[model samples]
Target: MGNKKNLFTLAYAKKFLNKKGLELFKKSNQTRSSNSFKSLSYTVLSSLILIIIFFSSPIINNFKNNLITQSIEVTNNSKNKLENVLTGKAIENEQNDKLDILQIFEDIFQYEDKSTSTVRLSASTIEQLFKDTKYNLKDVRKNKL
Candidate 1:
């Protein structure tokens, strides 16, 4: 019985293959091979890129460190020049003026919350609260939030 079934299946497959022609089969095989080749090439390209970045990371870090050190040295030189031209008392007064300005800004923007009340609502109540508003779930979903 199994042999008969296998032979029937094979005969049907052969008939179908003949109807489709060898050209179609060849084209599909070529397409599959090209797709695999493309995937392999992409994998190799990405690996090469990662390897290059890995090998060059120390050089990049050294360049960044050089830039940071140069900036620190420049700032130190500028600070020394300023100190040379200014008296101690003048520098102390300048720092005091900066602190006073910062304090004024802090006072203007200071916030204190003293609320001690708590309110809780059920799911239905929450739904009702948003039923007539644009903040409903439907609107939120439409807005992709």
Candidate 2:
């Protein structure tokens, strides 16, 4: 091992040129000689196809049209749902017409509900409402997960 000189430098490379060339060729052949040609061709063909699709005006226009149509569809669906809720059609049960904690406090403290139509809420009723809302919020979070 001591007698063998480190011949990796350019000046000494010529002495082991044949051995180094054989090793490099073996590595190259193992990696990308014949078996990888088909894969390389497929990659180039796919890249060209993608580039063409991206550059083609007709394809670009079609993609834009599809996006616009899909967005319009989503907007129309949400609009219809909002319209249904506004018309009271979305409310299947009359029990769903109750207010939440924030709404209850706002209505109570702010004196927003001046009408004699609804009954005034007591302290026990408020406590019960808080408990019910807490349970409902927990149930909703659990369902989401």
Please report, as a residue range, the 10-residue window in candidate 2 with the lowest summed lDDT.
22-31
For residues 19-84, could you state the per-residue lDDT of candidate 2 as single tens digits? 665432234435456667988999999999998977897877888888766653322366667788
> When superposed on Cα atoms, how far off is each prediction in RMSD?
18.7, 18.1
Backbone clashes for every candidate come to 0, 0
Give the TM-scores of the predictions, in the order they appear.
Answer: 0.31, 0.23
Report how far residue 70 has shifted in candidate 1, in Å.
5.4
Off by over 4 Å in 2: 1-33, 56-118, 121-145
Rate residue 48 of model 1 by lDDT.
Answer: 100
Which candidate leads the pack in TM-score? 1
Q: Which digits, one per residue and each the tens of the lDDT, describe model 1 over residues 99-119? A: 577777777667334344868
